[model samples]
Target chain A: MAKSKSRTEAPQDASEDVVMQELPTSHQPDVQDDASMAEVDAEDDAEVEDEEEIEDDTQRVRLLPGSTPTAASFEFLNEGHTLGNALRYIIMKNPDVEFCAYAIPHPSEPKMNVRIQTYEGTTAIEALQKGLKDLQDVCDVVSDKFVAAQKDFKKKSISS
Target chain B: MDYDPMAMDEIESKGPVIKISQADTVRVKFELSNADISFANSLRRVMLAEIPTIAIDLVEIEDNSSVLADEFIAHRLGLIPLNAEGIEELQYSRDCDCEEYCDHCSVKLTLHARCTGDENMQVVARDLVPSGDRINRVLGTPIINESSDGLGPLIMKLRPGQEIKLQCIAKKGIAKEHAKWAAPSAIGFEYDPHNKLHHLDMWYETDAKLEWPPSEYADWEEPPQEGERFDFNAVPDRFYFNVETAGNIPPDAIVTEGIKVIQQKLASMIHDLGETEGGENGDYNGPRSPEYNGGGDGWQDQGFTTPYGNGGNQSAWGGGAGGTTPYGTTPYGGAGAGNGGW
Candidate 1:
């Protein structure tokens, strides 16, 4: 039975492999047919290269050049408001953080640049790590409560 | 301010608490107290978009004589929720090492329907056959017959002599990519029932209560009396959530999964921060070391040697939090495992 199934699906699988390989290059001619479209494609290609470069580098978090550890703008690749806003909130809760804010340079780009200025006692990197730890603790508490509540609900429902 | 014993007791009892008021297979209503607005909103957004589910992603039609266009049927197929009981075991198609798709990453479902008699025939999700035992259509109570096998969502109808043959590949994905993979049909989040924080401006003709009636949840707390003084310093710390699942997963599992997603995201960020090279003033030339290309294998190796030198034991992080790799099955290969750090 397994052999029969594989035999029937063999042709379909081969065709799909071809389709996958052709997918990226198939749209190139359509864009090149028009001059303005070609220009837009070129710009898009440059943006893709930028994204690739960011991805290729193992260091997702980088300290911007010409910035001090105490006051710096750190670039976080492949992150958006989900992490940015939450991190900002957690960092701001600390008394040593003088200023903290995050901004996405562009909407299309998956990058979040956070600027942090801390008081003389602490550095921005330390504050950021503390914020991440605090946020994880918060999530742990929430998850535990949720699981306990769910169990209680289940028991009550079964008893009733 | 003096430290009063009564206030201290109040503070001790105010630690985070979750109360489940209602729960069933497909719906759950719960209250989360003592968490700030940021945490509550984050959980809600993650549940709606981040938690992964299985859905028909690619469809190939071999023959279709039905009135509907092939694209229309394919789009409808993508919306049907498949059982995702063990979806975490399945790797994402993009992350899997296959040319197109394999059983490890995708489930093949085929449907062949042909009508011959004079009567019209109806095609439903039950007719589609799955290639593997792990995935199948979510079957709810039958609308027509109670004793019959639970019915699935209707796919299409066919007239006499009309036929439709198709093959669909179901893959695991998050709602962030497409709504078809959304875990919940609707998630109702409410906070500040009395509006003491004035988050919303109540617009009404004469009486605010008459036009905008309070939800049933408002009864959980005392309703504000007429001309009652409001505390401006009060911040909304309690959140109420009503989650209705799309039947791909259980209601409680969705909440836990969402929380896990948030934890994994934070863990990966922290892990990356630990590997960052340049913190010295005026020394950022963009990660000069070509050896640490941030590929899956490179980071996996580095996690063992320099496992968060500053941050204590990597295992203490999100690694054992859920007993699963933080980004083990994540769609983005860049975010996956680094030794003890999930």
Candidate 2:
């Protein structure tokens, strides 16, 4: 039965291979036509490129099933030096995204608040989970230094 | 002491509210009563003061209490928010002994004279004159006789940046400076600051599921202003917004495409879960539908075992937990026409 099955598959696979191999080579004349039709085809190619990117992303996503993704944000609240540093980091990391931002002057506070928006697409629930995990990792790496900085900012404000 | 121009009892027949639409024309209104003639003359001098207001287009408010309004008032009070450094440099040389004024000092003069007299001002620099010579001298002082009871008029001149330091001259009933002069010099509307966050609010409104702020009403009501166009393409599905300011979190940032890919994978898994739940028959236990091989004859209910052929395993394609293969023997198709006779 297995021999018969292999024999049945062999003839069918051979025909498919022949068809696949000859189709492109047989269309050699079409290549010149493709060149002549380049401008219109270029637009088609761009759309195809976009689809290919999405397809690649879909394949990658399928491999990591059930994994949550999160967004990493950098806030610039009053500390110009830290903000400049954070902005530099973002620019370095996400060169493709156009960053839109503006400053809001705090009524009594001595400094301005700079708000920035970055575009990313991951569901909020997944993003939240990832964000929490990232926060944990950040906290661990700093060895509670992050907490200490917050306390310092608070103390400075209160003391002043 | 200038009379309050905004005071209510002042008008005999209120003058038409002269609305100035032309950008070039300077509009000055004297809300003076028929009795207050001297105050009207004081306004002309204040208008001539050389303070300039700088216009900046801002997006958000740091202070909503209208400090800009106060700045305007202070302008009327003769205080000006200095323009850039160049103008400040110019103020130092408006009045000087040199034919071409130099930085030692310039005398800025604002004269509010209604009583009809010429007041020549002398501002002597320390370098040009000795210690006793440094003085702010009013050349001609006008004196009204006793029974007239009315201050014949008022006069005050000022240097740029210097406040108009003139008191209201008034008799028992006749008040002039107080009735016609503005308390603060208001810079034109160009310098008025606006909110920036409204830009985001408009973006949200373009596709928002939730309501934006109250200011959005005015924005929606008005036509599009320059540099302000709504971004209609930013869809809710394509973005995830968070209130980073509310918590001690990072500000708005977009995750990378890899993160979205992970999200799509998870979504697919959920879809698969639904499909598996739907495909599962009532065995209630065992590997799920995608893995379950229920007595495969393709017609196991009809009492045949091994759907593919003799001695073949009941599992389709015979692998443990392999993903569903598309060309598996469909349970609906009969093996042969003679096998299942309805």
Candidate 3:
């Protein structure tokens, strides 16, 4: 049932051909995750008490089966860096953005949440990506021009 | 270190696709297939460590009679994020050949505030005059002070007869070295296709499956949408990034440069790891022994079991790290026979 029949049938008694025919080609060194490989997320009660001190890390935010492919959001802890007007100014420039806004929900926690919404044809993320790209372009142009102007000023100053 | 670059499809997606963005805050979502938490976390790490920006590095206080100490004023000067307009022209002080600093490696900002007469004026970032006509000319406006809309956040109040003279040094650096050097205030990501959680006919707010990030949707109390309990696409591999900039270099530059830097680092790592540990650590990982794969037990999963071969024997190598050449299966492509074989 082999497609390539003319690959030369192994000589009946040839050890080299015998070894070649039995060679395993998809060798993957198994990674070790003692905790995970031992059991899945839903802990089996009988074997659950192994790592008592280590807190079980429960992950959320996964788009499970039967979930909508519509939207996504994220929260970032403000480490004292909130370029509020500047970032908003940049994101709003994108034409594909259907809805987007940033808000600070907590007074105690230094955090801000930014939500970017998109139209039917585009996803919310793509709009943010486009906006980010635009910002990059603007920054790059500014960087290049600043350098060029610096060079010009240096050259002119030296001659005078 | 154990990441499989090939298994990631989020890297191949077209757009992060902005969904909703408010002034100063934006939410973006993208997809990733066959990838995990490491992918998203790595981007955050890169933004925190890789993207370069300019900030005040050194401050020489000539005279200070203000309430703040000399060290405090210097520290304040260091926190100020300058206009990273001509950063491409600047080099890191660590990389530059100059002994201390030059125009190519650093920018100088000098501030001399003397409260003369009777008026007690506040010495602010605007009062700090940046030198180098090149940077100032391109900036067209104040480098750091005027751009950021706050009077006291980065300002120092001075009273009458309180004189402050200082020379500030600006240099290129990444956030990894110091928080003051970081470009982004906050940057994070999450798996996309945000589906609703449900239990016993009741729609829950957050999912418990994905770790590192709990349901971001749970944080807000918004009106439920139609079919919140229905799942359209269960497996979402999209990567959503929320980046808040610190206001100098912007967010997009941070994202683009972060990815580029991470790629460069990975490529360098591969190159560095490819060579043998022969020069110094020869004994630990010297030439391979002939009996290394003696029993041939390791060969079983080396490649795919090709049907074209005689019997159920031959295993053709599939694509993997460094990639397998099209010669059936064996890890010893170059090290075969007498070629570095012991």
- Most lDDT-accurate candidate: 1
Error of 2 at A22 (Å): 76
Better of 1 and 3 by TM-score: 1
**lDDT per model vs. reference:** 0.72, 0.26, 0.49
Give the winner by lDDT: 1 or 3: 1
Residue-level lDDT tens digits of model 1 in B129-192 = 7865443333211122223356577889999999999999988899999998898888999987
Cα deviation of B102, candidate 1, in Å? 0.4
Q: Candidate 2 lDDT, tens digit per residue, B1-342?
A: 122222212333332121111111122211112211112222222222212211111112122132234344233322111112122222222233456332233222222212222443221111111112112231111222233343322222323333222221111100112321121233221100123323232456454434444432233223346888655532111011111111111111011111222233334434433432342243321122122243332332221112222112322232433212322335754433323321
Give the alpha carbon lDDT tens digit for every residue of A48-152 in model 2. Answer: 677445433321111011111121222222223222232232232232323323232343432322222234553222322232233223223222332343355
lDDT of 1 at B239: 91
The full ranking of all candidates by TM-score, starting with the best, is: 1, 3, 2
lDDT order, best first, reads 1, 3, 2
Q: Pick the candidate with the highest DockQ.
A: 1
Best by TM-score: 1
Q: Candidate 3 on B1-342: residue-level lDDT in tens?
A: 122223323355332232322223222222222333344455567677667788788888888889999898888888875667667777778767699988778888898988887977877677767787444444212344334555424558788889888888888887767887777777666543333433223233674343324456444323348656666544344445667765676555566566565554433322322331221132211122112232223334222111111111112122233222333344545522233312
